[model samples]
Target: MIDVILADGFSMLTTTLILEALRFVNLAHRRKAFDWTIKGVQSQSPRASNGFTFSAQRSFEANAEPAELVFLNASYFPDAAASPELLAWLRNA
Candidate 1:
């Protein structure tokens, strides 16, 4: 499973492209080659720089099991959205 950690003002285009690539791989293999979940650093629904909003499965929690792969999508002043909890989670991950 893959975890996509979204930050406020993330790049929508980049995120979608990554998702589509994974989907393509699954289609080519004719199996569930990859499974992914969207997670937020602070808000459950993080807004992109283009003003598009994405509904994340959940917020990053300390107890949550880390995924095999992780992607951090952020743009435009990402530091503003960084929290201690998120930093800790990333460090432990």
Candidate 2:
């Protein structure tokens, strides 16, 4: 499965388009071509730069499931630097 680590303040358009394209491919092929887990740095929901927010399937701390592929999604101009906890998680992952 693909693990998508959506950083806080991610672009809504980027997230939507990627997921939509994946969904379309699955539908057209009539099979589960891909599976994804959207995760946040923590259990709290992440928000888009436009103030839109959504719940993640899991958090880095809460879930240790190994992933075949991992992706980081973040919008421009992040307000904060990557936390040490997140850096550690990435290193270990």
Q: How badly does each model clash, as a count of residue pairs? A: 0, 0
What would the per-residue lDDT of candidate 1 be over residues 3-71, giving only the tens digit for each residue? Answer: 998888999998999999999999999999999999987689989999988999998776787898989
lDDT of 2 by residue, 1-93 (tens): 877777878888888887888789899999999898888764458887789887899776633755787776777744353777766666766
For candidate 2, list the clashing residue pairs, or say none. none
- Root-mean-square deviation of every model: 1.2, 2.3
lDDT values for all models: 0.87, 0.75
- Candidate 1 ranges beyond 4 A from true positions: none
Report the Cα lDDT for candidate 1.
0.87
Instruction: Rate residue 52 of model 1 by lDDT.
Output: 88
**Model 1 error, position 76 (Å):** 1.7
- Model 1 TM-score is 0.91
